[model samples]
Target chain A: MDRPIGVMDSGVGGMTVVREITRQLPNERILYFGDISRCPYGEKDLETVRAYTIQVAEYLVAKDIKMLVIACNTATAAALEILRERLEIPVIGVIGPGARSAIQHSRNGKVLVLATSGTVKSNAYPDAIRSLNHNFEVTSQACPAFVPLVEELRYKDDIVTGIVIHQALKSHMHSDADTVILGCTHYPLLKESIRRYFDGRKAVIDSGYETAREVSSLLNYQRILRAPEGEVTHTILINGDSSRFKYILRDWLPELKYDMKEIELKV
Target chain B: MDRPIGVMDSGVGGMTVVREITRQLPNERILYFGDISRCPYGEKDLETVRAYTIQVAEYLVAKDIKMLVIACNTATAAALEILRERLEIPVIGVIGPGARSAIQHSRNGKVLVLATSGTVKSNAYPDAIRSLNHNFEVTSQACPAFVPLVEELRYKDDIVTGIVIHQALKSHMHSDADTVILGCTHYPLLKESIRRYFDGRKAVIDSGYETAREVSSLLNYQRILRAPEGEVTHTILINGDSSRFKYILRDWLPELKYDMKEIELKV
Candidate 1:
């Protein structure tokens, strides 16, 4: 019951999920792995993403994690099922949580999903939404530029970031959809611009927030929730250069006290 | 795997949860039991609520339900732990789902829970919220009149309904809490008036909605989600007169096709 949760993503984008878990379930420990060296799994082939995901999962499993969360949309689209089959712990993905959030928020029964090209190609969002209720309609758009913007920490540059977001969303801004799903983890960094694009008319969902709530529900259901009196600790493991990842970690979690280490993962 | 989910309530209040499960997971079948003869368990003692809940749960279990949902807050506060200990199938309550939702929406880390007298007395919401994060501040108010308004079908009497809601919430309207939880399943029927009382300043969370989403997440996690191609059905069983319950059912779910029956419960 005291085992730490393992969270992995292609890069620091997954820190969004980490922030939620820390804020929502403060007593539980977390082990985060960012595959920065092989970052941008969004453009990789399904087989390659699955291979990289399984490699990182195995490493975390050996270290004794109670659960596994695939924070990368592309990686989840490629590897969620296979990981659930191979791993004994509970395995969760971003797509189902995002889709469920969209379903809950949509008033017009129309949803728009914005994700990396690889996730869009996999049609995971549509499948997830339709599987819940076929009456709900889905539209997907691939934002190939969004991940790089977040990875390079250029999301804070409002002028340049605004242009990139506008270029990707302008065509769909006037669509009939009443809810937008931030299907990729990196997309949350650009949420303000996306909300502005829609002029605050539509509900914008952050998958990390929903995924964090799901984690809380599942932990409580399984009776593995850490007691509030326990001391909380966080360990972040990066498989690539640590300089930029460290910078973003500090910016996103300014008050967080955590230990960061550079680890070489065999994949 | 195709077994119907069993939902029980002290009275018709739980129809709100059934409505959500029907909307969110359209493929799954549901069997609802409303103990109308022993209605309004909110004013009853913990021992009495637990005894009544166990009697209903036993009847449902004999029918072979895959899961049991305690859709009433009072029943959940009293019998949730005991039911989990005794039942082999998964048992979920509304309190945890509501608490998680308030945590997700509260910007100031302060939440207000509006529930029945029994739920407030049990302190389940505060405990559930604090168990997840000690930083959260929870305040509970026992709205003893809210259930009567919903059950007697007087919620539509805006003048009378408005007075009752205003009297209950006027004192806490100026509090630092940024989120309001409709902790009782019956409270959602009064949502519009409650929203107006706050002047649209705070986030209002409906426990039934969050509970349905958790049900969906758990079902998916356990790989027991019914396929979309399967037919969906609903059955309502009442232990008392069905005249008013029938009227409310038609009013709340106009398009929902279902069957209703009157049954005598031993308890």
Candidate 2:
């Protein structure tokens, strides 16, 4: 019952989800993995991305986590089913929750999905949203620059960040989408800019927040929630470099005390 | 994959969940049972409630449902864990989803739970909300009269209905609760009146809608979702008189085509 919940992403982007999980389920311990060695899974083909994701997931599974959360949209679109089929514990992904949130918020039955290129090509958000609600009209935009902006630590409210987001969403500025699903975990780091770029008109749905709520619901329903008195720990593993990761973690979660390590994954 | 989802409630209160399920997952079939013979499980002791819920769940499990949703809050508070342990399929409850929704919606930490006397006596809502996030300040008000208002078909907006709602929530008019949780399934039917009573100030949280969103997420994650091409069916079972149930179904779901039957449970 006190087992750590494993969270993984292509790179430091998944910290958005980890941030949320810490806030929502404070009693639970977290084991985070960021594959900085392969930071951009969004540009790869589905088969390659699936293989890389499985390697990362297998590493976490071997550590005996109680649950696994695929915090990367590209990885979730590629490998969530396989991981769930292979893992004994509950495996949750960010796609379904974001799609559900978009459905919940979109009053006009029109939604805009902002994601990485791989996720857009995979059509996971549109499929997930339309499956739950057929009447919804979905529009997907691939923000290839958005992830780079977050990963390069350029997510500040500056002119360059504004220009990047504006250029990415220039076409849908006047679209009828009442809800915007932040389909990528890293996109939440750029949430303020994206919202401002849209002039705060559309509801920006955070995949990490929705995913954290889903995790809480499933854990409680499964009766596997950690006891309130259990000791909480956070362990972060990065495949490439730990210096930048450490800086980002400290900035995003100033109060979170955790161990950061750099390791070479066999993958 | 075409297996139906089983939903059980104390009585017509569960219809709220069924309505949401139909709207959210149109391809999925529903098998619903109402223990109208013992209509109000809210007043019973915990042991009695548990026994009655298991009896109803076992009946649904025998029908080979792929999933089980405990639509009644009191029954969920009492029997969700036991049923999840005993049943082979996925079991979902309204309490966790409601609690999660309140956590997601409340701008302030203060929240109000509107439920039956048995649910408040069980201390389930407070425990559920606090377990997920300790910062929340929960206030539970047992509106025992609320259920009867819906069950006796006195939910219509009239002088009596207004008086009942006013008296039920009289003490909390000036309270600091920023969110109101409709802990009982039947309470959503009285949503408009409740919101009006609060003068559209507090955010009204519908457990049925939140639970339905969770059901969709779980089904998609488990890969048990019905195919888009699958022919959908709705079946309703009641342990006692069903003429009233049938009328309510028609009124609540005007376009739904369902098979209604009355049968006695051996319990």
Candidate 3:
């Protein structure tokens, strides 16, 4: 299908998936929606997240999207199944790809999952990992402050950040897990800090890169890949400010030129 | 006048000013515009920032605002003059208020300015301070990474944050300056960390609060203060995702309720 692939996230975290899709399927056009207004969906109730997800999906479907990528972990956990059943297009979530990567990398059979409150509460990673291999042991930790900290760009702050990260990781450090999964996409930006905290003792897995690879394979499997062109124009829509988003994006995905557009998502 | 005052910036940095305005003028209604889509006007060239400021000013004028507040340092530096010339209503930039605060608070003549590139490059603070009293020595530093760091919420992150903050403040630490002006709104969020780093040796001035006081004075001088009401609703407009903007706003300004609307400022 020549129609654009629709991707939606609670915020910029989903850009990781978009970055991947663009790389894997160079020719495909993507319509991305970053719901920056009510982001950090990990802390919200599941019902509210599901409703928001449905609203975004419906909006994209109206735009005639060929596929849907629920780039947000919380939304995927809360609404992916219903979204797939309700929509005619294939709907993919970040969980399965992340789980698969964790399973592949876990040599000790013990895996630690770090995500937002909603994703941890949903037990999505554990469930997904177990579905693939029942023998794999999964431990989940909800880093509530991580999303906000990342959004506020506090990744490098030493004193306060050290305390927060330490508090969040204290349990995982004592756990029997040797492999850790960055369940939330936003967590990837803190990979270096997280890795340092782990001090080479554990393998840190970035689900974003793996999720991107999964998206590539899926497009190839379905034979829906777009051909690479001379110049690809990426449109970034934020319900809020696009300045910081654009800045980080330039650092994260340097190839594509970003043109930010502001849109109103109805309450 | 019944019309609300219009305040705008590139992103959440303006909230510092908005917070003060709300506190000082509880009866007044504010229409705040955070152009999250094209935020951090500090890095952009003069022409781009000027155009963006005019665009936001025009939008606010269309809403029948009584006055306009350029809550962003970059916008103020690049476009305050043009805005005052072009717009019929009173236009206020953050630089003057900040400079005034620095001057009043400083026991010693030495004052340090920490702001974005645009503000530093424009030399607005020094010029404003010198305009008041040329004898006062003004030192300005352009902290380019500070906005992004604050936006990313890196204040809590220990190692990376410490490095960035230390680097930004290194030169100012040894200076004889008794007062440091947070020339950018975003700098306030890093206040605690900044304070801890400074160890209370120098008093920090928040431009937002000072700007709010200026806005109030301007309103009183103009005789356009609105009557106090039982309920005051703030109408927020974002060119991007309204939800994301609302999420950040709710966090930034918890006391104020926002009725968000989506707008397109493509021209």
Candidate 4:
């Protein structure tokens, strides 16, 4: 009951999921491992992404976490099922929850998924939503440029961010989807621009927020939810220099500031 | 960093504050002691309220909390300053944050505070808001029956709750207070009906939410926030049978399920 929740992602983008989980489950401690050394897992091959994800998951499981949350969409697309099968604890992913939330908010039966190239190509969200409701119209738009811009903290520069969003989403601008699922956790940081671009016509589904809800629900159903208790110091690990990881924590979640530890992944 | 946060309330209404604190600072464990044996501190004399408040405060202080939150408005009105002066850790109250939030949200310089009779009589919010800005119009309405309705779980019954609200605020219907500060934590539970009664014209300032933010800011500024770490189970102690407390927890926050311990207060 006192074990922390384990979460792994490719890079700081998963911090969005971390932030939501913190907000939703404040008493539960988080054991986060951001594989910054091998980030851009979204651009890698299927087997490579799965291998990297498993390595990180194994590290978190070694930490004796009560549950596991795959905070990255790309990793979820590649390795979620296998990780669930291997791990003794409950495993959660962002794609299914985001799809479910978008499905809930969508009025026109039309939904769009904004994700990394890997997730879009993998058809994770499309498959998840379709399996639940085959007739629901789903569009997966890959904005490959979003990850780099967000990582560089260029989301603060509205002009450049707007241009990138416009250029990337130009083809799908005319589509009348009432809901847009932010499949990439990083996209929520650019929600204002995305909302403005659509003139507030579409409801942006932040998969991170939905994923937090799902984790809480899953833990509750399993009767293994952490009881609210003492001061919990979250553990953050990276397989590289902690400098960039530190900057991301301050910028995204100043309230949850903590030093990141360097770890050897033996890659 | 692993010390618990002390929260003292007159009765179950402050569970609303506990709920927000749990949501806002999920990683930090809460040490809550509700005086269910002598609840409705709203009806007590100032000195009596102060004594009871101090007793609970001292108990929590002994529990070695890093900070203290006065979760009840009546108790805050009566004993916040004394408690702060007496305690070594940072101590916070619901009134100031609610007043500040109301001032921030109000456009017409018109604000109404819905509080228990004790708080209204003490003029806690009006004085707090006006002390910051002298020209702002402030009205404190005494919802004498609200606490009981909420405590008895009558708020779940819309008909009685609606009639009680209507009867309580009949005279203020024409008054254009664009911001309604929920001075009593219990008032948040009745927010939907209150909003509907006002036809969504007034923005509800949930003091509990604002108080949670204040606690976070204070802790962050003081550099005393609990680092997110190992599992932490919150300690909840009530000065009487905990059957009602359990029911309220389930009703108000189903996601947060934990056992409440019964304790002797010797009031």
Name the top DockQ candidate.
1
List ranges where model 4 is wrong by over 4 Å.
A1-195, A201-267
Query: How many angstroms is residue A183 displaced in model 3 relative to the true structure, after the best TM-score fit?
Result: 60
Per-residue CA lDDT of candidate 1, range B79-112, in tens? 9999999999889999999999888878789999
lDDT string for model 3 (B97-135, tens) is: 777667655777789899888888888889776654455
DockQ of candidate model 2:
0.58
- Provide the lowest-lDDT 10-residue window in model 3 chain A: A214-223
Q: Candidate 3, B260: how far from true, in Å? A: 1.4
Q: In the order shown, what is each candidate's alpha-carbon RMSD?
A: 1.3, 2.3, 25.3, 13.7
Reference-based lDDT, each prediction: 0.90, 0.89, 0.79, 0.81
Against the native complex, each candidate's DockQ, computed on alpha carbons, is: 0.83, 0.58, 0.01, 0.02
Q: What stretches of model 1 exceed 4 Å from their correct place?
A: none
Q: Please state the error at residue A91 of candidate 2 in Å.
A: 1.8
CA lDDT for candidate 1: 0.90
What TM-score would every model get versus the actual structure? 0.98, 0.93, 0.49, 0.56
Candidate 1: the clashing residue pairs are none
Candidate 2's C-alpha runs over 4 A off are A199-201
Q: Which wins on DockQ, candidate 2 or candidate 3?
A: 2
* Model 2 lDDT per residue over B58-148, tens place: 9998999999999999999999888878888999999989998998778788999999888999989999989888878999999988888
Chain B, per-candidate TM-score: 0.98, 0.98, 0.95, 0.97
True contacts kept of each: 0.87, 0.58, 0.00, 0.00
**Least well predicted 10-residue stretch by lDDT in candidate 3 chain B:** B213-222
